[model samples]
Target chain A: MKIAILGTGAVGTTIATKLIELGHQVMIGSRSNTNEKAIEFVNKFEKNASNGTFEEAATFGEIIFNCVKGEFAMTALKSAGKGLENKIIIDISIPTDTSKGAPLSLIPELCNTNSLGEEIQKAFPNTKVVKTLNTMWSTLMVVPTMLKEGDHTNFICGNDEEAKNTVKKLLHEIGWKEGSILDLGDITASRGTESLVLLWLRIWGTTIGTFSFKVVN
Target chain B: MKIAILGTGAVGTTIATKLIELGHQVMIGSRSNTNEKAIEFVNKFEKNASNGTFEEAATFGEIIFNCVKGEFAMTALKSAGKGLENKIIIDISIPTDTSKGAPLSLIPELCNTNSLGEEIQKAFPNTKVVKTLNTMWSTLMVVPTMLKEGDHTNFICGNDEEAKNTVKKLLHEIGWKEGSILDLGDITASRGTESLVLLWLRIWGTTIGTFSFKVVN
Candidate 1:
């Protein structure tokens, strides 16, 4: 599969390298054509990896992974242009307000009313946006089953059935089990997954460790 | 231990029964002294159970459990009056906005800035407030190990270390394993646990089953 990973941050680079290992063609996108991390990533994962501007990468791949920080998400997607239209976008950005004094916090936009995923979908009317991988650390996003006792769950939500299934298949390729993949119906469900970051961060702070959430029956 | 559960809803009643089984003296509190559910709960668990007005129950116990709905939480606690002062109050209420139009939603009062636990603590300054058990169903709260594969995590947070330790002890008395109890810092951390209800409700809606969240390392 041809994949575009927007935002050359930690999450984008990490997943791009993993996807390349899984035999998927990956393009690392950045605001600048000469992004140092993007260039370094392409050099490290030489064979099937490339670097480009956000718009160029968006045009280059069949699927787009929105891994940019939530604050910059709209600007980045808008830069991706019409190429984002009619594509499967797996959004994993958290709308964090870096400006908030001390410990940092999420913006929450209009509070509990709408989610970043819903906003992205509203912005790009033709894009099929699926929200996933925002609930855990980037390391766990691609290899959830890697933890010693990891039978944890990962969630996905999207308006389009086919798009959701496509994203689910990609998640499976990356090692998430089918049973652990919870489809939380429609894009509005993203509100729940995205909001989970508040809990995840608190858990991280006190434990001083990284972890993922598993739903126990 | 003498425990007062304010609110004769399923959560209040269920935990009251479990406390009785655990050999704790349990009082079921309600707005009205003759709430039918509270009367039946005392009849069912006749050995160590009783029913009373919120104030009577609050004064009757060493520890208080706040199990009322978020909307009614303040009123219930205020009704409990100065009796709740200096007592360990285990708050399990999610600050959910039951009045939301559709799909149900949380009222991010002060918008991610505060939580119901914080609000309650602020309301009753003399109370030693500890937040726990808001993340799962009432059935799972008392008998978490009853589920076929039940080795999930439960979180507790409060400013008073001794208060939190007391709540942890109560949790252990109800079958929660020591390793599964996560202490997530001070009372402000309640924001994270309360916010988690959004995801819990979403998971419940799609899965049509009761489950609790466990943090997988």
Candidate 2:
């Protein structure tokens, strides 16, 4: 599978590396094709890895992972242009407002009533936007088995059923068990997952190591 | 110990019953001293249970549980009057906006930057407010062992350390293991727990039975 990852940050680089290891072609996109970090990422993997501008990467892949920071996700996707049409976008961004400093706060406009996932879905109606992998640490996103032997839960939500199923398959390839994946239904559910970042940060503050939520019956 | 539970809803009655069974004198408060549900709740456990007006209950107990609906919590507390002074309030309410109908939505003003727990704390500056048990179904609050052998988690947050300790002791009496209870810092952390209701409701929409979150490493 050809995968496009938008951003050259920790999350984007981490996911791109894992996808390449799983034998998928991964294109790490950035503001410019010449971005040093994207170039460095491509250099780390000789084959099945490349660097390109956002638009080129989006056009090159069947599935796109919006790993851009939540605050800049919309702008980055807009730059990806019409290439996103009909493609499945696995949105893993949280609209965090860094301006507040310490104790992390989300962007007010996107907090409760609306979310980045819904916004992207609304802006690019032709695209299939599935929101997942935004609730935990970037390292946990690609390797669920690293903690609790992959017993924790992962949530996904989107309007398109087929897109969610495809994303679920990709998640399985990345090491998540089928039982660990929870489909939260429709894009609106992103509000719940995104809001979870608030609790996640607090838990991180108190705990000694990385953790994830397990839904126990 | 004497415990007061404000409101005659499922949560109030449930917690009231548990307190009585645990050998604590329990008072179920309501808008009127003659509320049918409160009266019935008191009658269920004649020795340790009683019913009264909000102010009467508040004055009768050393600790109070604000089990009223989130939208009306502050109003109910205010009606409880000066009797709340210096008392510890175990607040377990979510400010759900039912006006929109179907698919739960929180009151916009309290959804992100603020929460009902903080509001109750602010309204009664002299009282100690500890927020917990608002994230799960009412039955799970007093009998956590009913599911997953009580392995799931419960969260509490408050500005007062002593008050939090008292709440923790009470939680132990209600069947929650000390390891299962997580202290999420000051009252502001209530935002995280309260926001969890969005995800909780969505999960409930999909699952067949009651469930709770267990933070796993």
- Write down the RMSD of all candidates, one decimal each: 1.7, 1.0
lDDT for model 2: 0.91
Which runs of model 2 end up more than 4 angstroms from their true locations? none
Residue B159, model 1: Cα distance from true site in angstroms: 0.7
The runs of at least 3 residues in candidate 1 whose Cα sits more than 4 Å from the true structure, single-residue gaps closed, are none
Most accurate candidate by lDDT? 2
Calculate DockQ per candidate and list them: 0.69, 0.77
User: How many clashes (backbone atoms < 3 Å, residues ≥3 apart in a chain or on different chains) does model 1 have?
Assistant: 0
Give every prediction's interface RMSD: 1.7, 1.1
**Model 1 chain A — which ten-residue stretch has the worst lDDT?**
A102-111
lDDT of residue B56 for candidate 1: 90
lDDT (0 to 1) per candidate: 0.86, 0.91
Clashing pairs in 1: none
Candidate 1 per-residue C-alpha lDDT over A68-187 given as tens digits, one digit per residue, 9 for 90 to 100: 999999999999997797998999998877788644567857246788899999999899999998888898887776775347888999999999999998998999888888988998
